[model samples]
Target: MTSTVRRAGAFAILSTLSLVVPLFDPVTAVPVAAAVLLAAFAVTDGPLFDLFAYPDDYEDGRLYGLITFVLAATALGLVSVMSSMSTAVFVGTVVLVGYGNLAAAVTREWTDNPASHAAAFCVGATTAGVAGHAISRTLTGDPVTDTFPKIVFLAVAGALLAALLRDILILYDDPVVMLAVGFLCWLLAELVPGLGATEIAVATVVTVAVGYLSYALGAASVAGMLTGILLGLLTIVLGGYSWFAVLMSFFAIGSLSTKFRYDEKVDRGVAQENDGARGSSNVLGNAAVALVAVLGYAASAADLPLLGEANPELFLFAFAGSLATAMSDTLSSEVGGVFDTPRLITTLEPVEPGTDGGVTWQGEVAGLLGASVVAGLTYAVFPDVGLVGAAIVVTAGFVGMTVDSLLGATIEGTAVGNQGVNFLATLSGAITGALLVLAVAVL
Candidate 1:
């Protein structure tokens, strides 16, 4: 085979050998791990710095050789002065960077191809998993049961999802941004209480299963599936299974409605691409408001004193309102388009089907029905809120739907895409719900 392939194989073998050393002789594993990692760096001819250069740009290996030599010498020099923890951190950094270099070198050829990028992603994921587990082992002596390991698992899993999806989703245009989003989502999930080995395992399994199911059903693209996994896990873990049921109902209603007049929508040139399968932006736009509410609710439950006494009522209202708005807007557009011609919300004049800001009596009525479903379910969760709270949810949802139409007709495509419109509408619904509850409490 080629020289690079041979070098990669050698490096992989060294890494594997280093990992197995712990099984044979635990005491010497540390020094041996350090040696193997540094040797892998040398064997690969310094893959790390090479990543900084263009893939086509060739460099003399001797320069990298000198740099590696200098770096190794410096690391050795610091060993005398560094504390145990400092030395461990330094070594860990070196190992991670070495693995990263290998991944970058191997995937350089397939940088532009989504499917081919998996090789590089696998390398990165393995590195992250190993480092995270090692840290957990150091701290708790049990990687499987510890806190940090679960966080690492979630982070790496989300990263893998993002890497597989970034090319297909406009929301994740930048790799850094996509990775940051995954990190943040995991961070929030970590803050939830009672997330130990069992919860983490359950969340992982459910995320994977839901992701696969959504993809298989053609309800979502790969990006949307990734987004769904993150959102669904948070909803289930923090909001309870009943709330998750309500969440799924919204997705079910939206997806089925989109398919009601799929062929006609395509003919009209107003149909969503990929047979109305949603993307990352669509998923985030619809669910992000509810996610915020989930985070707030969890924070309240965690009893963070700074939050000034957890307002559970406001949290419930926000969550219900967001779902209600999303369902209402979706049904209004999809189902309304199926029946009657629409009139511009801002004007008395009739407009063609699928026109922005267009609405019909049939569509508005259908939207109310959609909103009612969410309100009813939400009330079922909080029966103490009574029928008035449900009424408030439906009204706020309808108001948000109205705002969506108004924005769409006025300045949707110019200043914001459909996703942006949806997000704002959901936010509006949430705010309205929170305000109404506060008003009732004050009076």
Candidate 2:
């Protein structure tokens, strides 16, 4: 057998261990699984290592993958024991991870075509969804239709996410992929119960269509497109179409700003890499915080009260603030790079156009405009927020953009990369917006 086939077969067999979880109590199952993994790890460096090792795996990579797979199963088991409704979800996650890996491995060995590999992964995930549902029905004596749509949705989403993660992470991609798929399946199973079939169908269709269009237009790479689709689906389903519109508004603004003076920016060495085509890092840096806000909004709507009282308003403000900050920063960098000479934000010393912490009047103005556009759309979509909430978003955006510049000047190059700064800026924007809303409420 090829090394790929060996790896795939090993994964499938190991994943099947999850099936025995129901026989043991959850508490015992976790420790037993952990012990087994520990034993395997201990022996990995010994003479028996080749039995479980793949030829292409880095030192201990195969063991790491096994550990992650076990962790995923453990998480699912815990969720299953805690909630009666989640048992099937847990089973579905295991099946999807196992089947998806198996299929992807076989496809990789058969052909070098990226599209074919992706198709195989999705097919495996979908098949797992159906088979898992059947197994769950047999075990729990539940009807076949119970949570069927949700299982399928989670499976496909997990597959796409795994594929995206595989592209981005080089060292521990397989492990991360498995862990991510498991978490996604768990999360969606809990949250998606409230959504109707039509709503889910709509979100999926819109997200896929938009993702494809963005890729086709060269605004996003394959990984970026996948990240966008996943984030877009969650946003629309949890926060509503209006929320998704706001996200798209940010994307549109950012894309346009990047293209505004493409040749000039390129000539000046300030252009985004790959002709401004965004990748997974760019998408996640700008939108991960926003996605968190969407999750908060969903939890609020569901009245889970994970964070005190369910305050959808606060999350909404945070969501808008995050996007506003992202747009502001993007426009400031792109437009400011072209229009005016920049000065260091810290000392007012003349600096290169692309210098860290660089500031320009033209850029600041463009940033403000970008913030306002997002804030305005927030008001239009969610009129309940009123002018005060919109104002908070704008203020948060400006504050976050300034913070980005400050960080860029002081510690960006040494302490953190550009993406790290972007994440922090968006996080600060989210916090600022939330605090403002709370202050207004207190008053």
Candidate 3:
């Protein structure tokens, strides 16, 4: 009983400190608070996350958790600094970070009760929404523009809530249900007499219609289609229609490639899961990093002496590179499966066609061809990317493909899942593309 009391008291104190310290000293408080919360979770197992307790590996878990906390803190600090000059961006960054925590909490599948998740998400979202609004107003001294933070919070929280309710109520993935939830949320937001309700309603309608059409076209699974819609909405809100169009082009290329040898692939037993239909995991793995780049670009257009200016060019480079990697990987696997034989990428020894690390000349050529197509698309879409930028995109794609093969040969099947491998490859491609842009600007 004493132990429980002590733990509870500690948590209360830490929670208070977390809230208070951030107000006075944000830089120090962010990481310290994260560590304290992680420690609290490890000690008491968290009220809603007891099943996640690691009694057997407490020390190891604590160490890893602390490391993650530190990394998160560092990232938050960077964002804070980058967005310091803009009140809207500053508020958005803080709220986005808080939203991440809410997401993590609510989506903890180990929790027994759906009600608990919903309650926690609602409370967290409300607090974050109110706090972001207040902060933006305080910083800008302009109530008019400050409303943006609240709207952003509303969209994000609504989307998350919709996802949670879909799982609990519908109990299955359905595009129609998800889109309905999204549309309803937007309608409610607009009905309250705020920013041009007609415009918001029209945009929402068009976006949802496009998403449904994509689903009917068989470009994505139900879950994938919904994910794409949500992601697209957010990106369009942050960037512009052109940016969203560039993003959709990637999907078009990737989906078309999956259909290239569809029947043969199924017969060879090497087809993508679900008849080449992508899911939410695939969408996120390929495009999440690009979305982050978009956010960064939205936050500031500052010039990093090393990375050049944060501009539309940089964002498109990241977008194209990641999509290029996804295209390369998909084309390689689907088209390469049609080859007579493949050799292990690492050993050069002949292996089964479907082996994780297997490669073929035909597949390699197809992968490059796919990457080049993305480069052309990127160059055409974003006028900022010239012929040199196209080359850079192709190079990044090739590099990512190599990384994918190396990881697959060494650890993909043994330790990491296929999704993880895909994410890593796309991440590498984004990094490589960004670096090339920086190099060119510097030179």
- C-alpha TM-scores of all predictions: 0.72, 0.86, 0.60
Q: Model 3, 333-433: lDDT tens per residue?
A: 77888787898899999988788888999988988997898888778877878899999999998888878887888899789988899899988998899
Candidate 1 — which pairs collide?
Answer: none
* Candidate with the larger TM-score of 1 and 3: 1
- Write down the lDDT of every candidate, Cα atoms only: 0.65, 0.80, 0.61
Most lDDT-accurate candidate:
2
In terms of TM-score, how similar is model 2 to the real structure? 0.86
Give the alpha carbon lDDT tens digit for every residue of 1-443 in model 1: 44444443444333333233223333454566456446434543455434322232245433333233234423432441242322222223233323433564467554664334543643564465447336534543344344554444444454544454544544212323333433444345445564566666676677667666877788987677767777777777777776687787788888888888789878877777889888788988999999898878877877766566979779888888888999999999987786557899999589988889999998899899999999998788766868989998998899889998999899899999999999999999999999999988888
Give me candidate 3's TM-score against the actual structure.
0.60
lDDT ranking from best candidate downward: 2, 1, 3
What lDDT is obtained when candidate 3 is compared to the true structure? 0.61
lDDT of 2: 0.80
**Off by more than 4 A, model 3:** 1-157, 164-203, 302-312
Summarize candidate 2's per-residue lDDT along 1-443 as a digit string, tens digits. Answer: 67566767777777666656544444757777888688667765543455456554355445666666677677667767876436666666677767776787788888996656765876786677557755765666676665566656776687778767766776335555665676777776667655467776788889988987887788988788888888998788777899999999998889888999899999999999988889989999999999999988887777774666867888888999999999999999999998557999999999988999999999999999999999999999997989998999999999989999999999998999999999999999999999999999999
